[model samples]
Target: MNKKQISILGCGWLGFPLAKHLISKGYKIKGSSTTVSKKLMLAEAGIQPYIFKLGEDNNQEIYDNFLSESEVIVINFPPRRIPDIINIYQEQIRSILPHIKNYQKVIFVSSTSVYQNTNDWVTETIDNKPEKDSGKAVLAVENLLKSHSKENLTVLRLAGLIGYDRVPGRFLANKKEVANGQAPINVIHQDDCIGLIDAILKHNSWGEIINGCADNHPLREEFYTLAAKKANLTPPEFKKSETIQFKKISNTKSKALLNYNYKYPDPLILVR
Candidate 1:
């Protein structure tokens, strides 16, 4: 049997580590980076490096070479924060649609931000009414991909990423009177992020939307404060607020379909 050939677009924080993990599992990796300097790093880590910036790199040949013969494509880049981002982000993904083979499967790295603050638990079936511009961009791209080729795509909506270098302790450390203290946080560790994706590939789970989040939702104040103290940083202070807005992301679909077991099932586990 032939080994799987996986192409990862935007091999920065999460994609870079994901490529390494997949390589260890005996998958051949073709990874992309906007920075030409990172070519050596990716190659050393066993990734076939392709250097090009989406939207700016108009060379179709580079994209073709990067995507050629790969069975799975992981679209892992986040939409840039800017005015008129909905159009811009949509265009970026749209540009690649023509290049993707009809048989190839895509795993789009979406975010929980696609769901608005309903102060209740949300699943894949909930209608997306995103609150922020970034969320709007991501949702637009999700729609674009689905409309383009719904059958070969799987959207993995992740919560706030924490683990390894992404220490929750540094976020709002020594901050005074931060807002949304009472709101419950939806977060997942980087390890679980990789694990969830692996499970999706292993099970050949496609043509679905899945949420990848920890099992437990911790109050923002509780998790961040404990995280800061664990790192020996000054804990942030949160103001008392009666108005709390939050959306607890549900991972039931992922668990049932992919048989995924979150390595860090609780946000507090990272701190404790």
Candidate 2:
């Protein structure tokens, strides 16, 4: 069988590792970097690196080359948390939709933030009511991808990613008066993300919306405090209010459809 050719946009935190892993699995990986300097770095990792920034001049040809000769394309481009980008981030992502159909499959890397914090368990079928700007932008991208492809698209709404080099403990270390102490956290490990995507590709699963998250749901205060201590950092203090608000993201759809066994099921244990 011919090796699977995969083009990954935004070879940053998650895409970089996924590229390396795919290479090890005998897949030909094409990666995109916004900066020219990173091309050497991507090449060193055994990825075919291309430099292209969506919504920029001369990007059409660059995107054409990047999408060419690739059977699967993973649109992992994430907007940086800048106000301007987050505001029009959907348009930035939509700019590439015109060039995506050449590939046999597409993975639109999205975020679980698309689901409003209804303080209820989140599933793939839940009604999306994004409250934050980031969530709204992600939803718009998801809709754009869906509109473009009926049979070849897979929308992965990833939960807060936590893994190597990403010690979540420090996010609010020593912070005081944090609300939602009892709220549950919805996070997935980078390892699981890679594994789930790999499985989906292997199984040829498309036209699905999957929520990539861990199986366990730990309290915000408990998980963060434990994470902080594990990293030898100061624990954050949460407000001891009686009001409890939380949402536990469910991964039943992805697991059942793909038969994926999570490597880091319980984030509380994976903090180390």
* Candidate 2 residue lDDT tens string, 60-84: 8888889987899998987677786
Per-residue lDDT, model 2, residue 251, is 94
Off by over 4 Å in 1: none
Off by over 4 Å in 2: 84-87
Q: Provide the lowest-lDDT 10-residue window in model 2.
A: 79-88
Please report the candidate that would top TM-score against the real structure: 1
Cα-based lDDT at residue 85, candidate 2: 54
Model 1 Cα lDDT, one tens digit per residue, 8-96: 99899899999999999999999999899999999999999999888665758888898999999999989888889889998888887
Which pairs in model 2 have colliding backbones? none
**Whole-model lDDT per candidate:** 0.91, 0.87
Error of 1 at 251 (Å): 1.1
Candidate 1's TM-score reads: 0.97
TM-score of 2: 0.96
